[model samples]
Target chain A: MMPMKLEDLLRTKPVFVNVGVRSFGDSLREAGYQVIHVDWSPPAGGDQKMAELLDDLL
Target chain B: MTLKEKINAANEEALRRIVAANPVLVDVAPASEVVPGMRDKLILHSGPPVTWERMCGAQRGAAIGMCLFEGWAKDAASAERMLAQGEIAFEPNHHHATVGPMAGTITKNMWVWVVQNKAFGNRAQCRQVESFQQFGDYSKEALSGLQKWRDIWAPTLRAAVRKMDGVMLKPLIARALQMGDEMHNRVVASSSIFANAIAPILVDCGRSKEDVVATLYYIGNHPFLFLGLAMAAGKAAMDPARGIEASTVVTAMARNGTEFGIQVSGLDGEWFTAPSPRVKGLFLPGWKDADAGADMGDSAITETVGWGGAVIGGAPGILTFTGGTAEEALGFSREMRNISVGRSPDYLIPALNFEGAAVGIDIRKVMQTNTVPVIDTAIAHKEPGHSIIGGGIVRPPLECFKKALTRFGEKYKE
Candidate 1:
């Protein structure tokens, strides 16, 4: 990961990639903030074994 | 000092006590043995105090199940009759230094996790998690699971917990926040950590191999097992904030399916209530929004002290279960900061560059911003004798916050 300057990050209009709760994004958009929704679901459709394996490896 | 200054100072002190409180998992014992005021035929429930007449379906089911579990009634009809006849005394879990999950019905014989807040010398308790009855399932299987806990699981885990001299929960929670656990809807990390902590103790307790394996397997399989302990810890953390005059920080937020309620630090035990709102989110196959019960549980205690939905940004894995993207999770955390009074000094969200989780929900800020506290919760079936139907996010009814604000004005405004 490359380090980004805090000042540079702040200079741009804030755009949000909304992952959950559409109302949250709606609230932000109503407040004039830009938002992009990500239709998020669990990796492997929430398989317990896979999740545990990933936890162990990661 | 002006009232405003005093309120601010008191809120800061309340937040300090909340962040400073260290909750340790001290023991596992029957509710009657550990929870003060717990007695035979007495039942503790979630949210504000509600009578049998007003108890929601799932709550009523759990209460009837408790009656059967306690042997006070032989069947559902008899149990309902006993409850209606006032043979069973009901009280809110908050009044008894305890908290429970959905339905949150606890009777005297149930085994409860005992957590102690070392800083304030206050203790809180919660019933152990089980798949069936607690969610209002009154089937034979659910009753059997409870019986199994009473006969086998409880004693095995109790002996193990005793041998380990009690498990310290705060350190595990601190680590879990970094590992994608918000300690509410998703507690995978905390659950795993707890299992890891007690695995060796169970092994060394001289229990039968079958019992040890069964106990460990049970703990490992249930990812939300830590939620009960987390609720107890949250209760301990927030209990000290109660009765701090003029503080507007919310100390408790709970739902009983019928109504949602909150208690402010300044007002102590007084609850401001509104009709419990319907949940909006994903549901299981064959189940839809209409089948879902209203939001329920005392698990929102996690949000009361920080973490849970207030820090969702740190727990992206929860997005999969609750339906959200990582960015929205992060956004949720930042948005909560707008309505909260301070950041937790201990519970930090790694996804937000290790920023402290927002803490101390302030009624003034909530009303001013037109934003209420959000909670990620599991939805139960609308009727009893059914398992959880889905999971979703919900907000405290705006009316509850507005009512609190009105009360604050009446009490503090000159």
Candidate 2:
């Protein structure tokens, strides 16, 4: 299967999560890609997944 | 064997290889005259310095461009072929007691920054900086821009250099170091001083305003406008100290596209090397991870000889690209202080409360700490073709240091 292009990935997923600096995400959205930034440490990976409990959104 | 001994051997071997390669300085001409096998080669770049494996991206591209410029090859493909064929030589600037800016390339015919150690018969060379090749970007704009620099900017600079009684930029740089300007990212003070020194000569030379303006603008714009000067100064300092039997001080560090190399005081002019490490830093806005090239060039010799990234705290602005805060920069300076043989009374740092910049990196410290030297450098993605997209920090592999240390021990086994 072909990998999804960033544009395709973004069109389906209106929001995105960037773990590091928000600067990359901000620039991405400016290029018409919607992204949501999440600032979390390595230990918080589990909590982050739980926080993204968007069964309805999915 | 003691780690120091091993390091000395490595340094010796590295030096022997470089000297045996018989890399002679080419023409007394300027950068525009860069043909090939010139007596002087200028290196331009940032970081801990690199060898060939580390040479990548814009630097590699530029190396190819340099081959084209020198007529060594019809294009990059032929250049690579020549490099592989071993028909053409691959010598680092450090081997010649020189430094290069980003994607540093010194072909024959190009005028080089010629700084002979009047005290020791030793000499160093470096290439001129591009007029506007900041970010090491290899866009259409960047290539054309460099061409303009070669044709128009370089000749004018040559004329200006000729007019001036051979500008010795070290004193100016040393003074600037004392005055709030770090020799790396924050060279406002250095640039101003250089401009002041050269401006008078330029004005009196009776050149056209556009040429003069262009030259002045180029000099004033790059914070590292003093890179050539610093390489020359470092060469002066280290050349005098070379061939000290028990001394494990590094004399030079440089990279081509295939290896990272180092030369030590004890080793004289040998080049000990290991695979170069990939640089860690911010990438360009649009480029993907695959679009970058590996590390390339001889510019890092500046840091290996001291200055560039070694004294980062002296230049806080470097934090943005080198992947650190101002505090980290300061810490880097302090850390380097622990390893050096002495502080440079000449290159004083204002931020460290008038402390002298770290002068020499001791081989013992590298072996004990396993902390290979860290350098702030621009990042080129692993892919080829694209120019420099972003920059950050990187550390030379400890293996190189270990190898140097190990070799030093055997060579001087008493």
Candidate 3:
């Protein structure tokens, strides 16, 4: 139910990185992108996306 | 000698020599402005506890001098009168973002190191470790020693600092970490590196040869000066991560006059505290357990940030005094890596083949492992009477982490 619009229509052939909530069922499914999901815990303070971005930036 | 050999060999001897090197009073300020979490009317001490009765005579006498220095009271009698009147401020050095070695006193005019970490946009501060008043050994001898330090010693050194354009210790510390010098009880590599770095600066600063030589000898002799620099650097690195929602990074670990409090990253500046724990370790010769004090001060953050005792094997010499085995020291270094996020490429442990010391405290790893951080610290007595007796080990209360995780969960949950 977590806006699976991207998950449902996505092609099954290519693996996609799934940056989704752990609460979402599709989180368990395979995709092109490696799945990185946050647990029931809330997002931590600071830039949550900073790590992924640093990867992109650096 | 190779820089490494020179540093390691001179490390302790340097600490011994710093006592006589004559540290001039560079500057002084109130604890609140110079250090964080300080309030008026409270006095701060260093290391672990020593009761008023058992405190080294020298430290007690220094406290009397501090009282006079602060003008809190006219003399020891007036100071005692004010303290007995409950009008004096007594606190631990840890509560503020500063560290003191023994009977650590922060007055309005003491020169402190101000370290700014450009990478993190934070600052950390510390007082000089050159002198020893916390020993409770203050007497006519001790008071004269303090006077000489303030008038004669502190100035020659302050001039040196002026000549050198201030010290940039981060690079040397980074190199030491890689070279097997943990910045805590063992500072051989760091001290040597510091001397090497400063020597060039001293030469270029255009100071008199004698002054430069005096400063050089002083630095060459006392290995612990870098401890303040390392603490300041660690403070700068860690302060930025404070107040991040759901981040479990610890900001400050300090002992107030009465309790040990830790501020976690996710909690955003809330202090979770517990009664101060006692330091466990060997004491100086002739020192007995009854004479030891409870844990005190904010310097342990160096370990929390991964230096101090966390990398003890890098300083095997300290093991003799701190009551640790080399194997255990090595184990501590490796175990710390497990909970940390990265290694400081600058600070390398030589025995580990120039492996970087652990850096960054990861909250997730701490939550999963339940390994509360360990810190090697000095102990002071609980009551206001004594200054510092000896040094030992302590653990940050686990509740601080538990509470941080609980809050981080709530803040980030969908």
Candidate closest to the true structure, highest DockQ: 1
Candidate 2: segments with Cα more than 4 A from true spot: A1-58, B1-28, B31-60, B71-89, B118-121, B131-143, B288-291
Error of 1 at B66 (Å): 0.9
Ten consecutive residues with minimal summed lDDT in candidate 3 chain B?
A: B16-25
Fraction of true contacts reproduced, model 2? 0.00
Query: Per-residue lDDT tens digits of candidate 3, residues B42-118?
Result: 55654323344443334445566567655676667776666555575554454454566545565544445656554
Chain B TM-score for the candidates in order: 0.98, 0.79, 0.75
Scored by TM-score, the top model is 1
Q: Residue B378 deviation, candidate 2, in Å?
A: 1.5
Cα distance off (Å), candidate 2, residue B150:
3.6
In terms of lDDT, model 2 sits at: 0.58
Best by lDDT: 1
User: Per-candidate TM vs. native?
Assistant: 0.88, 0.71, 0.68
Instruction: Give the docking tier of candidate 1.
Output: incorrect
DockQ of each: 0.02, 0.01, 0.02
lDDT of 2 by residue, A1-58 (tens): 6567866865674666776667889998898877877643332123343223211111
Decoy 2 TM-score against native: 0.71
Model 2 root mean square deviation, Cα atoms: 14.6
- Candidate 3 segments exceeding 4 Å error: A1-58, B1-65, B84-86, B89-97, B120-122, B135-140, B143-149, B199-218, B256-258, B381-388, B406-414
